[model samples]
Target: MRWWDVEALMPLERELFGDTAWSAEMFWSELSHPETRWYVVAENPETTDVLGYAGLLAPGLEADVQTVAVAPHAQGQGIGRGLLDALIHQARERAATSLLLEVRADNEAAIKLYSARGFERIAIRRRYYQPGDIDAWVMRLRPLT
Candidate 1:
């Protein structure tokens, strides 16, 4: 995603993730390192409002999904899947053998999405999410080939 999109994405990000939402500087930092990072945003065609955003980090043979968020009103419309597919394609392009992501344990929809996309739960990080003290499921998709 471009620097311009950060502003447009803030409201949605805050609304969806609340205390866990990323700061503007975080997005700027990620975008500054385009060589190892990829971020994308989906927008409404008419109003050009941000519908969702996702990011990936591929520094070596293993790539990680940094984040994936869809506007609540736009959920279940395949935007998340499309964004995820983009990350997978980018991981393959970077020659990554595995893709990893951490999802909140209570996020059944997201877990199902990742599972359907070939990611398997490898472990769980206790109290990985702050405030709510939620657990995080560590998932991995290997053999990118």
Candidate 2:
């Protein structure tokens, strides 16, 4: 995504992630390293509103799904899957042999989506999230092909 999209994405980020939402500087930092990072945003065709966004970081043979978020109103409409597909494609482009991600354990829908896309739970970080003490599930997908 371009630097211009950062401002447009802030509201959505806060809405989706609440206390853990990323700041504009964080997005800028991620965007600055385009050589090893890939990020995309989905916009409403009519209003141009940010519907979803996803990012991937591929520094070597392994890539990480940095973040993925879909607006609540836009969920269940394939936006998340499409974003994920973009990340997977980007990972492959970078010759990433595997993709990894960490998701809050209570996010059942996200976990199901990752599982359906071939990611398997590799471990769990106890109470990885703050304030609420939520666990985080670490998942991985190998043979990116």
Task: Identify the runs in model 2 with alpha carbons over 4 angstroms from their true place.
Answer: none
Model 1 ranges with Cα > 4 A deviation = none
- Cα lDDT of model 1 by residue, 76-140, tens digit: 99999999999999999988999999999999999999999999999999999999999999999
| Worst 10 contiguous positions by lDDT, candidate 1 | 136-145
RMSD of each: 0.7, 0.6
TM-score for each model? 0.98, 0.98
Model 1 vs. true fold: TM: 0.98
Q: Write down the lDDT that model 1 would get.
A: 0.95
lDDT of the candidates, in the order given: 0.95, 0.96
Candidate 2 lDDT over 48-128, as tens digits, reads 999999999999999999999999999999999999999999999999999999999999999999999999999999999
